[model samples]
Target: MSRPRRFLPSVSLLTAFEAVLRTGSTAAAARELDLTQGAVSRLVQNLESQLGQPLFLRERRRLIPTEAARAYGRDISRALDLVARASMELAANPGGGVLSLAILPAFGTRWLAPRLAGFLSAHPGITINLATRLKRFNFAAEGFDAAIHFGVDDWRGAGHLRLFDETLVACAAPAFLRANPIRQPADVHALPLLQIETRPTAWPEWFRAHGLVAPLPRGMLFDQFAPMTQAAIHGLGVALLPEFLAMPDLDEGRLQRLPGAPVSGTGSYWLVWPEARADYPPVVALRDWLAAETADLRAREGAGDGADDGDRTRTP
Candidate 1:
């Protein structure tokens, strides 16, 4: 009552056909599978006979696939890939590898690096490899498991797990503010200004937040945040820095503000990873850990309740 289905070829036959289609020649397939060319050709011929369709045509001495073969090749290639991945998963362990991450130098040192040893301690089987990217970037091509970078949803080609929504602020040493009174935004122009090489518009944005004008550049620019803050600590000028990244200096009283103004971070720090890697163990774990840590930090900052407005803008 029903036509019987043709028996499917063996995994060996399917693998041989797949290898030839992918590698473009029987000799190449033989090299990949460690089989003789005649052996590989026999496998493809056997597969063709089972389906009763010619998959390749003779071109010179080599067999070339027809358009129909091209279509079949795509499906078979995908299936074989799924099977190979499953096989590897059954044979491999995820928890024992190194988690590679790219991070901004200052954020890593000032905020993240100080706290990551606890993560390493908890997962002794795992380790983290950290490298610095002074600017923002794509995590996939860099071969990083993850990355911590600045900016608002600007990076493409990945999942953006926001770590923190930072609030930027202007700060300086106590002596600088005591000597130079800063009552209004207009006063900032007369004093020395400290600029971060990354965010050239930071000061202008602060002024815009408080209804001041734009494009004010009367200070020195540094390539990194820690150095910019250091210059501020030494009272070179007022530095516009992200508040969370500057907490240590603020805590140590190395830097203080002009008074009554600290701008919330317009940008965010996000953990980025290629979607293809969404399920890797170290990546998922680090993303969760960083998210939780940032939330806790934000909660603590909120509870501080403007009590330490010392990080407000200081005079040059």
Candidate 2:
């Protein structure tokens, strides 16, 4: 399309022409628009120049409309009014836009998603669109409003408020712990180690936390926690699991914490967003809500729904 130039009529011209055609005189249109008669006449001329069609006939000190002018004016006038109404609605509420967020599938399903209705109840007008990702993402290019992401605090160009500090426990089936008899940290070396792809060195890390620096065990590593924890439940092997993520399994008697120390993982979760839009209304609201949720969980000390945590299964 050609760029708008000096010769082309602007929307001002169209407005003046339409007004004059409705009222039958440039002076009347000028009065209605709170402008000078000469200014309105100029606008009519500009409109003709752009449309390449005379919108009005020069009558005796008055403007007479062409058939096309009346039809176009009615449609454009209604459209402009509708635009004004919609713009007013949006300006009244900045928090009502679709909130696009990226999250890990398991974490979203396990934690944040379950409690999302709370946010919705307070901000019902806000729409949420969730996209799942296994790793951190580029917030700007991805068009995300915020992300509930897991990793060490390494995100660049994003404002990261740490959601939680992870406490990882080595948990296995009760039957497995009974059969394996992990009397000390090093005793984990003897068991068949079930592991996840992201943290195969968990056993080493747990051992290191207790002052033992043996090589991490070799084992079957899966990409996700659900399957890896399931392997632990079926007595496949011991898996180093996050207290937040694995606590439920331990409570259900599907897994038990071994008799050893806990390893701190790189991080747990963070409410992340681009630095530019970090203070946006929706982002700030979500950040506050998630921080509150994490704080509440920490106060419970891994005990609420996950009551049967690692502490009880320590086989003295």
Candidate 3:
């Protein structure tokens, strides 16, 4: 009828085991833990005795971890990281917390950077850190509180709020446009059309939307728009660029829109965070502020004329 006692290893024993496994020697582990080498050895021996297994193989002066110890070290690595992060957070934000965000490079620079000042101004107590991540990542493992994600609402294990759809317009450098002189959507097929690896069907979809059948030949491929826009400006070829990313170049007379109306791409930007942190204050504040900003931008877009195509454009 009595409950069985739980047998948990002491923190020192676990730390010694992890340190020895990581450094491959008790001496190194002792140096790392700031303890005597004899103490570290005793701790590891105690841990092995408690677990009833040999964590290390003794060969002369060398200590080699068994496969089981190797796996255990890997498991404890993440736990140790979380502990360190928690300690650092406690030290850094005694009065508040930090919000770490992962963002796409082009979108972050062109869109989010301009708006981040307002967010920081309002949330003066919270420290906001931004890192550029071109691909989706594990939020918990990477220590991100939220991310600016593009594409559909399919980031596995995260809750997403749609920010804005992407509108892609065909663009070329002014000199390239002058020399190429594309008159209609069909004229684009004859030129070197730059392609974005993420959106392979952009050109074909645009052509289809305009009632034209494009062969959609392969062209020079670039991963991100910052470089792709630069390539287009340097007269590499015409590129299908998001209207917002292309605006500065258009205004500076570095790039020009190819003949035809801008077509909608099949993706949108989303503010994504882990579902478990849905009600967390920082995440909620960011989500609500983003929603308001998106609504205001949409209202402006709706009221704008074609003169500022960047503001007026939206993807389907």
Q: Which 10 residues in a row give candidate 3 its minimum summed lDDT?
A: 307-316
Q: What is the C-alpha local distance difference test score of candidate 2?
A: 0.74
Best-performing candidate as measured by lDDT? 3
- Candidate ranking under TM-score, highest first, comes to 3, 1, 2
Per-model TM values vs. the true structure: 0.62, 0.62, 0.87
Writing each residue's lDDT as its tens digit, candidate 2 over 105-154 gives: 76887787778999988777776779888876666446677887676545
For all candidates in order, the CA lDDT equals: 0.75, 0.74, 0.83
The list of candidate 1 runs beyond 4 A from truth reads 1-95, 138-140, 297-316
List model 1 lDDT by residue over 1-316, tens digit each.
5665565567898899989988999999999999999999999999999999899998798888999989988877777765675455445635466677888888888788788987777667666778998776555335566777687555566667666667787788888887887877667767888887778767877888888775457778888888888888888888888887777888889987665478765566777776666677777778777767776655655635332221111111
How many clashes in each structure?
7, 0, 0
lDDT of 3 by residue, 1-316 (tens): 5543234676778888899888878999999999999999999898888878998899997898999989887877777787787688768976657778899999999998998899879887777788999898887778788999889777777777777778999999989888888888888888888888888899899889889997757678999888889999999998999998999889989999988999888887888888767777888888888888888665654734323222111222
Error of 2 at 73 (Å): 37
Worst 10 residues of 1 by lDDT: 307-316
Q: How well does candidate 2 score on lDDT at residue 61?
A: 70
Cα misplacement distance, residue 98 of candidate 2 (Å) = 1.4
